[model samples]
Target: MNLKRTFGAILTILGIVGVIWGAYAFLAGGDSVGGVSMNQFSSVVPFIVGLIFFFTGISLIKGTKDTA
Candidate 1:
């Protein structure tokens, strides 16, 4: 079992999910809390983090590949 590849796969999936959810939230608008909306923060942060996670995951997976 390749731990690096497995972990990378997991991260990649999570990143994809995060990016989708974040985009949805950003477009759909977020609910107000105490009359203060966190729409921008919630959406932007997740989208950025998701991108980071995705790139990191890809790097890990590629890094673990056996080269002939």
Candidate 2:
């Protein structure tokens, strides 16, 4: 088992969940992004972080050579 790959998979999964949650929360809040209040802006954080996590995990997994 590749530890890095495993960790990457975990990150990817978390990223997916976070993105879904953030997008849903943000959209469901019924406020346009341009009109977002400070409190509403909080919902966007997960989305940005999720994108970072998703890309980081993907790169980590792809760049890591299989030891086996």
Candidate 3:
């Protein structure tokens, strides 16, 4: 497999996991830090980041497949 595809696959898997975990955290209520609930902002951040990673990885994998 091409390097791009390999990396993309890894990113895709990680992104999926991140998205699931983030959603769970957001719904279940994440841990608190200094009296502030992490679900307030932290969970959202991961979900957004996971989306980015997922899309980027898909693009990379598709682009590589087309070229190869």
The lDDT for every candidate, in the order shown, is 0.79, 0.81, 0.79
- Measured with C-alpha atoms, the lDDT of residue 68 in candidate 2 is 75
Q: Which 10 successive residues of model 1 have the least lDDT summed?
A: 31-40
Clashes of each: 0, 0, 0
For candidate 2, write residues 6-34 as lDDT tens digits.
99998998899878877876876755444
Q: What pairs collide in candidate 1?
A: none
lDDT of 3 by residue, 22-66 (tens): 787787666763454676468887788888889889998988854
| Cα-based lDDT at residue 58, candidate 3 | 91
Model 1 spans with C-alpha error above 4 angstroms: 31-38
> TM-score for all predictions?
0.78, 0.81, 0.78
Model 2 CA deviation exceeding 4 Å by range = 30-39
Superposed Cα RMSD, model 2: 5.2
lDDT of 3: 0.79
